[model samples]
Target: MVDADQTFVIVGGGLAGAKAAETLRAEGFRGRVILISDERDHPYERPPLSKGYLLGAADRDSALVHEAAWYAAHDIELHLGQTVDALDTAGRTVRLGDDGTLVHYDKLLLATGAEPRRLDVPGTGLAGVHHLRRFAHAERLKGVLAALGRDNGHLLIAGAGWIGLEVAAAGRHYGAEVTVVEPAPTPLHGVLGPELGNVFAELHREHGVRFQFGAKLTEIVGQDGLVLAARTEDGEEHPAHAVLAAIGAAPRTALAEAAGLELAPREQGGGIAVDASLRTSDPHVFAAGDVAAFPHPLFGVRLRVEHWANALNGGPAAARAMLGQEVVHDRVPYFFSDQYDLGMEYSGWAPPGAYDQVVIRGDAGKREFIAFWMKDGRVLAGMNVNVWDVTPAIQDLIRGGATVDPDALSDPRVPLDALVP
Candidate 1:
């Protein structure tokens, strides 16, 4: 077992890393904790980047995980703008950036997070093309959006996922003409299924966001080193003064692969493999957040989630495991998103083609409803959209393995708790 006073190193200074440091201290570990961040700034929240901050509803300070003084007061060492060159797992050391600073650790946690995937088609590297991942990226995009609104220019977004939809809302709020091009027929089809995805599509359509559904981007057209339009496979050019690529993200796993740690199989999305306790193949190493692929107790499969709740919960669980504590880390998966006037909270997992039935409570056509995905009368997943004070009831139904009646669930008069037990 590692000693209390030994050094604990956490790579990737994001939400997971920050919370791990906080958990180690709260668990009474009097060890030396060091957090290494690639970005110069400390860890901050990412959700606000697409919603509040991007719309100028919030500021940078509001997104911070903690102020600079908090790190100093907590006696945690913060290394900003530093990259880990290599992980010497056998030697229990990490080689730092170009200077080759070597740091020894009794325990190491890899929360390296994920990087935004770039559009690889032609004319992607031109100016006025942006991808939102970092605070700087959001700041730059906000400026471009302001300019777009002032000139009433067109903003072309290449993806219709959560980020893409949220940015489209922001662009529309700022008076810019917005167009979203999704390869899929509907937005968020992979997660929410077609019925619910259509709700979002209709919502955007009501707000004047044009859709180029079932289309592939052939190229991004630029002139004088700035984006001017995006051409789809149909050979039609859409005017775009600025472009935002929100395709998706890939986990940062170079260090884990180089260290020879096990990775999830190809079918599982290629994340770093870890047990229920978040312990990696190496006894002294552990992983959390977006990079971790752990067994899901409810779904009976390995799952990797990229969202705020997973990182917030997994970090503390991994810290406890590192301290020689027995941990299952079996909390139900949860995530929430805010797009326009719609606020959504989703709990539980229903992998693609896993659920056989969907039951909706309230009026889906009116954009107020709770959707339950079920298999053989048992709830597999539940989503509350534009509905308030119902998440707890939905989560209890999912976790308790309660067989719910479809008629009662659809009835607004039926209390959610009564449908369970």
Candidate 2:
């Protein structure tokens, strides 16, 4: 049994932090668990903020991962809108905002997560330019979409990642002529290979979305309190009434750095360092979610994943580590995205150029396909669009390090049950 009066303090009120709290309770931890958050609302799912929430398909309440009543019933204290000022790791206390009281913690989990990255270009501070990360940011975008009410108004998007493409699709659905600008030759060059990126480029182009591949943002011009257009180094000006910066997210490692914890280079500025057991340099402290770049034994490298699946799975692993459980938690890295009536799913871990064989489970022509990643005859990762039921099965196969015939797996007649161990 755990200490009755022990306190567990969790930073961030996103899925990772909330799941850590839930996992702690599920493991019979009856101690006081206080969840600190800078947002006004409780924990919520973030993936839908860019698509469903912006399109009016999902609401504020629906975005939340868990009900508020559930937290209250579980006796989980919420310090909403409380910004963590500092962390006294040696003292085992977290310093909060000016008025907020300092919290004492026996075990601290740093699930502080990440924030939307912004451009440093001129006119970026203009009224219409925005980046989506929190609920408030999405609300602002939704409001702009409602007020403008103009289809064909140029909406220029920076970056060509999944979120940027989703926003471009939404703008197209709203009848706005959208243009995507990326410094990379192809979209999602870091995750999906060039071939898949080419497919996405074609798909978006077919829907009337324009692409400025290999274009870089130089300046965001503003006039009289409104953004007018942005320029590229090539002296090209793209007229845009509004701009959505979807470059990427930077992990919130300010507190960790201030606390003098070990840090490592991530895709962004930095990600916190953690062992296979998910413990930081200071064993009493642990980090998870986007902030934690775990050392992946299977992938043979450390990875910082920013996905709902990762937050949900890693959160529990961090808690389990604190509870003295030995867990590798190197499960298949899975993620999903919902766009324009299309359900997309990604399962397992496929490093750059690691796959030698590509297996197609369904028909791509039918807009239903699952492309399995097989490296050295082992299934590493997959891309499943409109075919997500096999995600869990693929995840298990990857975890178990099992291999199957590529031809047999690709056939549409193959069952997910047969793919299982």
Candidate 3:
């Protein structure tokens, strides 16, 4: 077992890494804790990039997870713009950046997180094309938007996932004519499934956002260093002055792989295999947030959740394990979306191939509604659109393993509180 006073090295300064440092402190760890981040700045939240920050509803200072003096006062060292180059498991040291600075750690937390996946199509390197992964990436996109006078620019976004849609919403709010292209027949099908994706697709369409669903891009051509258009797999072409690639992100697991940690086959998504306790195959290291493919008790499978809630919750859960504290780390997977007149709250887990029921507790078409996914006579998952009021009741039902009565749940006049056990 690792000694308590030895140094703790956490690589990566995204949500997980920052929170892990905080967790280490909270768990009464007095060891030398260093957060090495390749980012030029200290840790910051990413959720605001797509909405509040992009819309000027908030500034960079408004989204920080901690006060400026918090890290200093906590004695957590911050290593900015320092990339960990190598991991020597035998030596228990990590090599950082081009300078080859090495640091020893009795225990290590590999919260390295993920990097955005890019389209390898031709002309992707052209100007006016971007990807959203860090604050810098979003800053570049926002700079492009600001320089082009916002609405005057025609923005073409590839992929219809959350980031793509969120960016589209931001661009739309700025009056830019946004076109989102998704090779899939429907957006977010791989996550929420096709039925719910349809709701989101319709929402975007109604907001005047154009869809190029099921269109595969063969090339992204440019003229004079500027993005001109995207050539479809079918030879069809569409004008695209600015192209934002929102395809997806892959775990930054190079160091973990180099350290001889057993890898979970990522043929499906390229995330790292982590046990229920967020421990990697290598006992000395643990992973969390977007990089971790953790076993789900409710889904009966492994899941890699990429959202604010997962990052916020997973970091500390892994920290508890690192501190020799047994943490169950169980929480209903939850995510929220705020776009154009809609505030969505989703909770719970869904079993695979179990397409059976959706019990609505309120008017779906109206501003407030709750939909529950039930299987095997128990509440399994739920999504509430503009129905924040009813979510606590639904959470209670899910927590207690109570099977919600569909007839009573759907009764127009019945309150969501009625579903509580």
User: Which has the greatest TM-score?
Assistant: 1
TM-score of each: 0.98, 0.94, 0.93
Candidate 2, 371: how far from true, in Å? 1.2
Worst lDDT run of 10 residues, candidate 2, spans 143-152
Q: What is the per-residue lDDT of model 3 for residues 1-421, given as tens digits with 9 covering 90 to 100?
A: 4465789889988888889999889888888999998987678888887778876688887777787688899999998888998999889899987699899987788888888898988888897789988877877788776654454777888999888888888887777778888998888766666657777787888877888888977788888998888878878787778899999888888988888886667753457788888888878788888888887776666778778888899989988898888776666688887878888888877633564776776666664777777776578777888866666776777777766677886786877676677
Error of 3 at 118 (Å): 0.7
- Model 2 per-residue lDDT tens digits across residues 1-421: 6787899889999999999899988999889999999999889989878888888888889988789888988888988888998999899999988575778999899999998898978889899898999989888887776554464477889999988988887787777878899988888876776656776787788888888988889888889979789898789999988998999999889999999988877542378988887788897999989898888877777778889988999999998888878878686677887667677888777755777777777777666888777887777887888875777777776766777878788877778668767
Compared with the true structure, the alpha-carbon lDDT of candidate 1 equals 0.91
Which portions of model 3 miss their true places by more than 4 Å? Answer: 1-4, 147-151, 267-269, 412-421
lDDT at position 46, candidate 2:
91
Candidate 3 scores a C-alpha RMSD against the true structure in Å of: 2.2
Candidate 1 — which residues are off by over 4 angstroms? none
Native-referenced Cα lDDT, model 3: 0.80
RMSD list, candidates in order: 1.2, 2.1, 2.2
Q: Which scores higher on TM-score, 2 or 3?
A: 2
Clashes of 1: 0
